[model samples]
Target: MWLPPSPGQIPFQQGIEAVSERFIGAPFIDNALGEGPGSHDPDPTFRLDAFDCTTFIETVWAMSLAPEPKEHWTDHLQKIRYLNGEIAFTQRLHFISLDWMPYHEKRGAIVDVTRDPGLPLAESLTTIDRKAWYSKMHPAKLREFESRFPADKPIPAFMHYLTFQELLDNPQGLNRLRQELQKGVLLANFIRPNWDTIKYIGTRIDVSHQGFLILKGDRIILRHASAVRGRVGDEDFVEYMKAYKEHATLKGIQLVRFKSL
Candidate 1:
């Protein structure tokens, strides 16, 4: 097995699996992280006791990437969770399609292989209007971001994607996507309609859920923290996709992998 340079601990993608596997039954808490020492956001800056989906992935990846013998995972988490490693609330990569993936892609940290997994690739266009979005947020959350919210102008981005129906029908695409999972690519199953006007958050997001896709022999597993499940858990990815077929806005899955972890 290829291991990252972290002494005895796994520190990359393989390390990611090793690290996350230990938290299979951990509790899931929404909006978990906060600026503990020198900023706003009351939640603890770091903790392994509980996690939301985003925090779970952030914590796992950070732990996998950090050098061992000194548990400095938070340092890695800062860079992964924020723009330019800023710990402030506003600078955090709140939107997955707009801020999170793109920022890491540019830094050579990750690569978006959403299209490489299939034929007949598609796109998800989302308009990000930070000012208008924050206007609808709760008073306290808005107060934390009011000073740094971006302009209200529509910044439309086309996120490369694979259509769920197409992948379901296209044996070729289905096979390829499975191949990617077998290769250890993380899968971000997107949910949210194009031109969606409903207020879900301050930033328009493409993916509503994300998880690591691990393949062992013929069995594929999805490891993630789910509030509905009330804990970090592993589920069959194919079954999960079948469930998403009944969802109103589940667009499809986006393929991503860490290149620098």
Candidate 2:
């Protein structure tokens, strides 16, 4: 069973809705921009090139639940779980969402897997033993590695940790992987992206009914007072999005507001 998020905790469920909206309106996906390295599975079945952070986390979650029995894992099943295949989490009941809201509660536990004292925070959350978990990169030392990437590099450098063979063969490996990702997200959010980042302060506007007002820094962005219901022209949606972007810039966050949720 799952527990509800406390009042002090950020509404990650709401945030997920907001993210979905942004995805619908975005000009281009992060994958198209070469956000991260493509998957390296030789099956010719697991080729995926897109947002590495989300993809990696999602895969870790899927692996945790094990969609099918180990002995029954066929080529078809592997393709379904692999990157090149349809990567929608909802399609598989095993898919897990590792956002802060679900795992940050008091009962939630995180297992830290790092040698350095500060890359990611997993040690303090869960009671699980650290030595039992397996990881190539320590959560505390990720910053040092990321620092090596220059500004000129369009693609972010991602450390290769797990291979298809290891993930499939090793028992209980996926759960460990999921915990590691949760730690990474916590550390990244804690140290780097605060509420100031435009991507974080998302907006939802209604076109047909009523919209909300969003304040980015000091600028006021108007969400369409009316919610968009049906048959709205794409051009009109584009215009509304433009207004939201303008408002975001005025507020001091250079963000592209596109989704409705």
Candidate 3:
């Protein structure tokens, strides 16, 4: 759920560069349930790739099923899974967003430089809808979401929003860029919510902006830039790669090269 800065806000790119340089070396701890690596009594609910907003929420829901840990809620989940055919003990790593999720909201602004070839960067952000743009690009995963609930719903596991200035200021929106990071969560490796690795840094931070997460041992960095038809070239890419190295230096974190999406 990360995207590049809109065509506008190009001036904020320096800030983006600064932020990415801040969290290269900070430890990446998982906020998901289960035990951390190298523990003697590993967590039973741990899954390899069960990261993302929806699966993160579902895992929490599943954990809240019982106080004593019997197979109480498995049947309830199975009923839901039969319709979607996706619930399983080991299949947690393969969860994807359902189709029925809502798409857009009227709040926030937008910038559309991709559609209009001649549109200037500054003009794009002047009149844009944040939800509208993402709605068109990534429609709701409706089948995965449900609305028939009680009086209320809790906040999502991770809520990210990034303005054009924020995106321009921090391309890799790592949490360590802020001065004081305050969040109501913990990174743990057991079912009891024992360990938590949530922290924040820098000035402006939101999930909607282009950011990367290194939970557990895996790192998934999301970037949405204009399709590099001709503007960006090999040299620019090399500079970007070098920027990663420099950012790692600032944060004192070492990052191994992973496959790009």
Candidate 4:
């Protein structure tokens, strides 16, 4: 069982390290959506006992920021999990690049350095049609979705991503990316494959997963809730990237650095 420290018990970097380390070997549970079909409305829902990739990162972030995590994590979770601190499924950040990254940047919660000039060239686009997904929802849920997101409206969403070939070709740029992988920075996994299926059933975003960067001495490690490994674990960054290269669905990565407010 992992226990989180109170906010200010240490700096954000140390706080993230403490929480992530404590959660190592914790079971990976796909329960972020466990509230299920009709329970889409936001209500400070989170579970530290188990986590998916997104919830794992969100939980650690909330724990790091709150003065007393046990007492204030719910409020911090709400603020970080939803846009403008509005508790609606529609307002929740559904896309990493399109919704979460930029919103957090604007709020000074994070700094997105994915487009730094030295990195590999990236392809940018909007995806995951929320309206399209809503259309197929059960009529009852459809009404709820519509009330939050008007069907006639188009939501502006976008993503920036690099292909595996680009990453392999840009050694110097890859070095730059490695240099930027500091403790507490959030690393988003951008998977490339059938966008239609992903957009329809998955998170309406280019990013498929996320984790925190933990640089120990000269090595960079990713502290994440791994569904494949079935628990929270630390993976060497380089090895993790190479493993993804074998997967046809993998694209590349996007990074967000969380700064203390």
How should the candidates be ordered by TM-score, best one leading?
1, 4, 3, 2
TM-score, every prediction: 0.86, 0.20, 0.21, 0.80
Q: Over the stretch 1-261, how does candidate 3's per-residue lDDT look in tens digits?
A: 223332132221232222222222222223333323443224433332222232233333333332323544444233222233334222222211111111101111112112121111221011122223223332342122223212322222221112223223454433321211122111111010111112221111111111222222122222111122211111232233345443311111111111110
* Candidate 2 overall lDDT versus native: 0.25
Clashes of 4: 0
For each candidate, what is the lDDT?
A: 0.73, 0.25, 0.24, 0.65
Give residue 41's error in model 1 in angstroms: 1.6
Predicted candidate 4 versus true structure: per-residue lDDT over 143-224, tens digit per residue: 7667776654444455566555565566665556556654335555565533446334532445667887777876767889
Q: By the TM-score metric, which is better: model 1 or model 2?
A: 1
Clash statistics: count for each candidate: 0, 21, 39, 0
The digit string of per-residue lDDT tens for model 2 on 1-261 reads 223222223222343223222222222112221112342211232212222222322322323233333422223333334333333321121211122212222223333223222222211111211111111213342343245322312211111122222323356433443343332221111111111322321211111111222333333333221223221111232234344433422211111111110
What candidate 1 gets wrong by more than 4 Å, as runs, is 1-14, 37-39, 69-71, 138-152, 195-197, 200-203
Rank the candidate models, highest lDDT first.
Answer: 1, 4, 2, 3
**Superposed model 4: Cα runs more than 4 Å off:** 1-13, 33-44, 137-139, 151-156, 162-169, 182-184, 198-205
Worst 10 residues of 2 by lDDT: 186-195
Which number leads on TM-score?
Answer: 1
Candidate 1 residue pairs in clash (backbone atoms < 3 Å): none
